[model samples]
Target: MSITNNGISIVPSFSLEKPATVFNMSIAKGRFSFDPELAFSLEAKPWYSLFWFRYNLSPKQSKFNMNVGTHLGLNFVNIPFPNAKDSIQIQKTDRYLVLEIFPRYKFSKHLTMGVYYLRSHGLDPATLNALNFVTLYTEISQIQLSKKATLGISPQLYYLNIDGNHGYYLTSEISLSLQNFPVIIKSTINKTFETKVEGSKPFLWNIKLVYPLKGGKIKP
Candidate 1:
């Protein structure tokens, strides 16, 4: 089980403007032990909301696993500075779509790897610029660092062509599982680099305490 809430700063890759602060929360859970199970996930923030449903295709095996999923979300951003010449920069909402699939292979008890591909698109009624997105994501994970901890690092490659933006980021995560309990406390840091920004974008920090109420562990 993994969960995270992010409090971060953002400066758009294509906009040379002051940075904005945003906060987001997420919850994810694997489903029943049966084959072809469901993985449920959700995200919410003052500026964004999202839901995900994924199909888990492996059960009772450890060598390989696969998943197919969909993410649907809404994004709201308010520009801090408003200009008379520029349209009001407040409360603009966009709808987004993300479809994904990934396959993972477990080399051994401690090592696993996976590559994920996501298609992201957004539609903005205010800007009249239909939202569209495309991204490639990949990760390698260490199943256990000791008896009580796990770690993973991932890199994301993005091409939001319709929004005229491109960027990439690397995320490092660590989780500590409680002894005699099902609780997990996790933290992550993400550093982003973008084509339009002069330097590295602001770093993001996320913390999540996850508890699975019911369900078997999902395949990666």
Candidate 2:
């Protein structure tokens, strides 16, 4: 569960991965997932779900590593009628398939840099749109405050293109956590530097309280 400034997001997720293995799989809902660009509403209500399967392509000891993944998504969208006079909103269901690739270089134990790319293809042309998203990011981790408490920060620059409309944005997240704690605190900020897309917000911010219910560890 995550309690954000906007609302509460209840995300129930399942993960299947083996240590030292090259393959991983996960499924979750209730949040915006870029892998398939499953857009959830800003409110707490969830209307989309995604399943992702990934495989690592680099050796275990490599400083630079690459991962390739795919996302299968089912989304429910509220599509307004073409007539502007009609005050009713119509709901429609759609599916999406996306391809993802990310490559990261670990500069040190505390620093890492990466680039992520995702391309989403809509299954229903009548209701959904294709998307291309790319992110360049750097992470700083393991800033210790105590033996068990740590801080992590990630800064990202991203580009999004949907149906020929495009935008450039900057985003970041700061997280604080304790080693044995079930709860983590995170704050995210996003700003649109430039955009030609409609309905894009110039700035957005949120604070999230996240809880882990199962086997999880904060590497931090």
TM-score of each: 0.57, 0.74
- Candidate with the greatest lDDT versus the true structure: 2
Cα lDDT of model 2 by residue, 133-204, tens digit:
889979999999999999999988988887898889888889999988888898777788988866566776
TM-score between candidate 1 and the true structure: 0.57
lDDT of 1 by residue, 1-220 (tens): 4344443322122221222223333345554211221122343324445566677787647578887877666665666455557565555667766666777777766566666666666554554243333334445556567775665654444443334544555555565665567776766565665443334345666676766556344477
| Backbone clashes under 3 angstroms, per model | 5, 0
List per-prediction Cα lDDT, in the order shown: 0.51, 0.67
Q: Which stretches of candidate 1 lie above 4 Å from their native place?
A: 1-5, 8-45, 56-62, 78-92, 126-164, 197-202, 215-220
Model 2 is weakest, by summed lDDT over 10 consecutive residues, at 12-21
What is the TM-score of candidate 2?
A: 0.74
Candidate 1, poorest ten consecutive residues by summed lDDT: 32-41
Q: Which candidate tops TM-score?
A: 2
lDDT score at residue 48, model 2, on the 0-100 scale: 61
